[model samples]
Target chain A: MKSLTKNDLTLLVAVAFLTLFAPFILNPFPEGSAMAQFNAGYPDLMQRFVIFGIFAIGFNILFGLTGYLSFGHAAFLGVGSYAAVWMFKLLSMNVIPAIILSVIVAGLFSLLIGFVSLRRSGIYFSILTLAFAQMMFALAYSVLTPITGGETGLQLALDDPRILGSSQTPEGNIPVPGLFGMEMRDSFDLELGSWVFTFNIGYYFCALVLIASFYLAIRIFRSPFGMMLRAVKSNQQRMNYTGLNTRPYTLAAFVISGMYAGLAGGLMASMDPLAGAERMQWTASGEVVLMTILGGAGTLIGPVLGAGFIKYFENIFSKINATILHEWFAFLPDGLEDFIVAILYPFIGKGWHLTLGILFMMVVIFLPGGLVEGGQRIRSWLQARKSKNGRPNGTTEPAE
Target chain B: MDAIILQILNGLDKGSAYALIALGLTLIFGTLGVVNFAHGALFMIGAFCAVTLSRILTLSHTVIDETKTDFLGNPLKVDVPYVHDIFGIAAGNAIIDWAVPLAILFAIPVMILVGVVMERGLIKHFYKRPHADQILVTFGLAIVLQEVIKYFYGANPIPTPAPAAFKGSFDFGAAIGFDPNLIIYPYWRIIYFLFATLIIGGVFAFLQFTTFGMVVRAGMADRETVGLLGINIDKRFTIMFGIAAAVAGLAGVMYTPINSPNYHMGMDFLVLSFVVVVVGGMGSLPGAVLAGFLLGVLESFASMREVIDIIPGINQIIIYLVAIIILLTRPRGLMGRKGVMED
Candidate 1:
């Protein structure tokens, strides 16, 4: 294997640092402060950030690298969740066997769907994957009630057999998901005057897994296989004419992405211990697509950034209501404050989707390369300006 | 046998909706060469037009009728619709009863306008972009449209009943020498089927018979050659988009009475309709219509109690299952032509 470039190593280090201290970085405001409401360091939200980040990274391997816009990755994610939960029910509370089982099951399911869907390209592939996912969703919601738990979703019961460990904890409670005897839900809080920060075991576990997934993704992106996937995206016709079979390359990418989704799903189940049929829906698939595109599809950090951005927005926006808006606008005149709240009301709270939709449209229209590209453009422009300003004192050549 | 006939009737009614929506989808795809993900939103808007019209008709003002007393011994205020004042109470009530049919007239112009604006404003810019870009933008638009509808309608299904005249079910089995309630079908569903047929026929005839249609067909086949021939094909395509929108809108307007118009109703139909379009063969109009009915009937049949007893969960996923099989085997769908998104 080829060694990582200096740039690649630097990027990996930066990502590792950011993810390692996310609890501190994400919670910039003090707990008692007004700005604390904007903080996203809570265990649940933090878990989602890394989990969805993993999901998007996997999705990026397929869609960003291979240009296969699968609208059914959620099916694999849901399958992973179900598999993990079942593993817990059948085996033990340890997340290792459950996560491993999830990846294997989701990989198998994706292989089957990909083998069929990969025969077609473009819109047809999208539709095919979508159809398969919908079929899974329908079955989960209705017919596969025994395995999937129907509308209520699959949950652990006290009667489940755990050959490796006790079914019930020493405290006479249903055993929580954990590694060996170490519980996932246990958290320690650090307080400093008005500031408080929580360190959760489950969040750290998810963060480590996300870092591993991210490292694997970076390896895949830099590998020869990644180049072949990109080649498939660029020109399938040319590759075929060159006597190179693109199907296996694409199928591998699809399976890899599917496993990533399964891992994310497993982590989610390890956190919550439930898997709903809605997790397999097309809209959920669309959300992953949105996250990938919004951050920048082909770029390494884009999917993770997009996932974090969307999850953060979903959490923050949904928490704001009319009362919050009123409080925010209270400094204005009496009539004007009420008027401002009324006007701003619909775009927040339950209307967050509207704001999200409009933002998505604007991004697609104006920033096709997404927020990453926008950042690059801004950085380049600023560099250009700085170079022009220093041209008199130095060489007149343009900065690279 | 009667039960089978009833199921078939149910299938046809459902198929009519699928066929209608798919027809508009195909029209847009054929002429504009764009895959419209927001076409379902147009159907939703059409349904809301009826809801809006009925609301308008029943707009009322409070009148203090001292003859009536409240439970608190205060004079009761009676609200009388303005329509009741202009046209007597019975006539106004009758007019409100026929709000849905009246919505057809109201929806055509509004749907066309909406379609034209959507095409000119957003879709026009996306014509030369990649299909992925077009799909994403249209999907975004669909979400925006849905959220807007939800904001106005409060996310609940608002029931819009059929007129009193078409409220009852007709005993078709009795007329055909079977027991009286054996093959009974709703009068509105029959009307809807007939209406869909008329619109489908009208669209086909418009494309097949008219000179404008001939030009549009030529443009669909080869745009550069038609442009070389000095025709303003873009404007005509825009009109065709409006027509397609009207068709979808009319379908939604009629469908309101079948299932209540909800904000997410468009999304509910969107995936299924796309499946119908794909199974129908991408840009093939007749294929879209044929596959729509075919899949719709298959869906109804799969939902039968006996079928469910055997297959267990076939009812929920029959359409998608059929789609996957057809896509894998047929590839180009049931009636797809050469060189239309074949890659």
Candidate 2:
């Protein structure tokens, strides 16, 4: 409820570290065991978790803090991605320069969009943002082909001038930019008995950046600036009557969030070495909104959890086929097995979206504050039962 | 001059689709005040209705001819539909040829039922929630609907052809004393334009002439006052939602020949239609249609080779760019009424 204490922060950091090194932690599991799937050690997905976490965290600063639900934040992310990719193509392969340039470009872009969109509050703001995002998407898909690469998307080639890194052979070899020859996919695998423990160097790099971003978010949340943003959310007219300009504060939040998106975009290109216009599509933007709301928008840990949950489901649900469903239902009677499979059929493959839709509706209908509020409700209910039995639980009610 | 006229004609056909879709969107938003993101999906289902009808009409049973071995030295097989015998060749051919037109009859009830179910089951509950919640739920519903269609139809564009009579181009240039090739436009596209005009006109006339429509319009202006007059405004609005869905569905059904139906086709148009609504001024019905046509025409113009060479992706973004300019300058849109979401 209260701001996290130093000890609490330390404990959270330790848990995060453990989660990052989960493959090593799960080294006790036999090779190809079902438990091995639980390992959050893959570089590609781990980078996604952190990158999207950054995105959702930035979004929360605006929507979670100010109660402004933006339907078009993906525009900024796309802008950031394009800028980062441009940096990769034109300047150097070094991520530091690319990320810096991306943040600045995205920040400027957001500043312009936010300035116009923020003129209207509530639903109008949402529509305006959506309009701008769509405009950007359409432009990228068609007119901006020279820059955005249209539908097929922009890719790095062997001929791209790597001013800061060693050049690879121009014949069918394209290199992913790295920090001083440290490849993004480079990983160390340790064999422990029958299990394989993998530690990706890229994962650690992403984790370090995520930690720094998290710390920055914490500082922002705890700052006076955050209080003003909350005030704007609560009552902008009152804030205006109080002789305070709320525009700058809202714009600042928007810009900061945009920069965070840029950082995420830069990291994405660093890991994958490509940028596509599809990344900027309104749906991609909507995904982050879902992640933020699902995780418990406004809460620091909620977006991360939401990101992990969605990504995990995306992976697991896509892997499930009709055969897999049949195998799972093999224990039942022949008639019942087919019946159950039929019922479960719509929740797998392309039907995975049906599951997500039902889940989203359930969350919105029941858990408005998302998983964080759901967690708090459970904790309080348990505490209430304990107190009724004359055992006072030390945990207090959560702050809004 | 001929090229310009042809382009204008082309623009009119494209504009008609945008106008119809945006009109439906605005109707729901104006009256119910719920942004129906699934409207596009309803449009898609309408197209799929034509696809379904075509497939049904073509349904056949295969027969093997043991004596008719050919190139592969295997038995030749023939496929035949039961309808081929029952209806005979002429009637069967007519049915197959007219599948798309006949689909309009089937699409109406289906889309209206979908609309009613959507309104009563989901959107009815969301009346008091924030617009964000409405957007999210509707978005989720859209995804669910699209995915369901994709699951059944697979993720490919299914071509639904126009009727044989409407297959060729109309020679407008010859009628106007110009070269025959200069102003040729597809007969189907002309039919689409006429269809859209009729639907739009019929919708306006119904609202203006019928007592029920008048009451519904009154409710759109003020629901509480209409309710105080002892009318069931909610039921009327629900009906209005159905009408809106039907309109969108009709648009989708007619649009099949122009562009093949895909699982994600609705989404491609949804954003653009929303932009049309905004540019027309939010919650304004006429504004939506006007903006839709205007932007659609502008988009067509932007797609000209010379114009495209100058501005590149201008055609793709022309509508959105126009929307931004209109929103910034007019704020309430070209004909936006005061106090309608201005707050």
Candidate 3:
């Protein structure tokens, strides 16, 4: 029995291996060293990487396959987070029930939204999704305060009744979210010589979910349903002329992608039992879009790569400040160093969004196919050079 | 009846803003055939133009006055505006007080340059690209412009008050023989309404009467054919983009007193304005203006205590709800041409 197509299987194994050893891989610098500031082995950032990777993967399935840009996709993720947090409050601290409920709730929510938004294609669909998301965000931030917790956000409280688990631990504190026996916050640090690799249960859990999400995405990409979605993207009118009802296919894809987003949201809340309406904001939606496009939207591994790239940069860029800038350029004369720091100040730390905005524009303007396409072009070019020396290159297919 | 009248007046004020922004958005879309997400940024820049002119007019230098002594028996140092030094104190003081109105003069040329550069440097390349690409690029541009504004002017809203002469509220109801002070409104808001009407009328008149406007209207109807007729329609569209920018900027400049200008204010208005544009009919100028006022009124009505008591959060979602309904029921929009963006 064949598992995956050779290239896909190779991709899956590589991803699995990378995720398993991520603590080591992400922590390249030695402890107490200047470069250690760049290390991202901590649980919070690592969980974010995989969680966002899952989001981008899900986003890619809809956008990359069908070319339908849902500008409000983050609404589903926000809904999923709210659901999961509510589950943690009402049912149990166990992430299992929360994850399942979040997925189901997100699926139903997306179904309702998709049914309405899918009426029109192109920019109308984008605007519809945007309006719905904005509407939800406003409601969640205001009148839905009883359910959504308003501006302060929904946080797990000490009084929350976890029917399956005790309301509070023996120490008289709120029970932390956990798998039946293991707490999400549990961490283990491994030291080898001067290097420190920190690992957390939450990060591993998220990584495992990401691997599964990635695998499922690959399966979907190789499926006939995905072909129909691609066909929808290329020519919906032609597909309609052929008597195909494209709505159901597109709707189904939208729902599935929404469920994937919900899954990511659930995982996020599981790691930290809180949810904010801000997650549903248009900027959050735009970030996922940027990730998918940056990584190469249509390519199978592209979204994951894009997700990692963005989250990692966001972390790194936000950590840089004037002091760090001055440290980096300390060799320059005082005037030059001050000038350079002033020039660079607005693109780092709290101003990282500006950098993101600029990068997003550049990517859309010059590299519409994303980083994956750029890589493919380079590889093909290298092969062409080899073919000049009499070794022919394999014909390449555009990322799908 | 008084309460209802008050809400309607509020709605008209809100509608004036919505109409102005949506007018510019529709103008750009109608002429260039590009969905510009950065058009709101132009509106935002216009408000900042007012802020900037105020800042510039008040540029001052320290002068030691011999007549006025400090507690230390030293001559008092006075900060005197450069404008006062240039054109005696009274004239400079007058110019500074009227900075917001003067910004209209400054913003027109600046906004036109911005619009032309955006059209030529960025939006021109996107004419042939997919709508999604156009949206994405322009959205990115919007963020960049917003961030650039935030960097220079901090994140807080800058209060650019209307001139002192128009500072107080005007009781218009008494003039109309209603109970005194029953329908009082700000002098500035009344000015804004008249100003919006003037701008809207100017745009319509420009489009209706001028050779340039005629060429643009013809281009919008059939670009290839217009080109075939040997008119440089692209150049006119670029100028149309400039005019649209000026309109949005002027609206922004006038709007600063009504709602203090902030960097993100453009985005806040942009989403609703897009809804207004869509509901008005995608490419129809009249549709956009009609839809803008209609939605504004509807939104105001929804926010009324009576309406909110029944629908809870209806006001929050009313514009979007209306837009969704209109989009579904009338895909061609209230004033949309049949073939334009139907697919």
- The DockQ figures for the candidates are 0.88, 0.57, 0.80
lDDT per residue as tens, model 1, B1-343: 8778888888998999999999999999998989999999999999999999999988999999888898998999999999999999999999999999999999999999999999999999998998988999999999999999999989889999999999999999999999888888999999999999999999999999999999999999999899999999999999999999999999999999999999988888989999999998999999999998998888999889999899898988989988888988887889998889998
Candidate 2 segments whose C-alpha is farther than 4 A from its true place = A1-15, A22-29, A34-40, A89-91, A142-152, A169-175, A389-400, B62-77
CAPRI accuracy category, model 3: medium
lDDT of 3 by residue, A15-105 (tens): 9998999999999999999888899888899999999999999999999999999989999999999999999999999999999999999
Listed in order, each prediction's TM-score against the native is 0.98, 0.93, 0.97
lDDT, candidate 1, at B147 = 97
Give the residue spans of candidate 3 off by over 4 A: A333-335, A386-400
lDDT-superior candidate, 1 or 3: 1
lDDT of each: 0.93, 0.83, 0.92
| Model 1 DockQ class | high
At residue B33, candidate 2 shows an lDDT of 92
Q: Candidate 1's residue-wise lDDT over A1-400, tens digit each?
A: 1487887788778778888898889889998787889999889999999999999999999999999999999999999999999999989899999999999999999999999999999999999999999999999999899999999999988878888877887777889999877799999988878777888999999999988888888899999999999999898999999998899999999999999999999999999999999999999999999999999999999999999999999999888999888888999999999999999998998999999999999999999999999999999999888987978555556878
Q: What interface RMSD does every candidate have?
A: 0.7, 1.7, 1.0
| Candidate 1: stretches off by over 4 Å | A392-400, B66-75
Per-residue lDDT tens digits of candidate 2, residues B8-102? 88888878988999999999998899988888888888889889988988999898879788899999998876568779978988888899999
Best by lDDT: 1
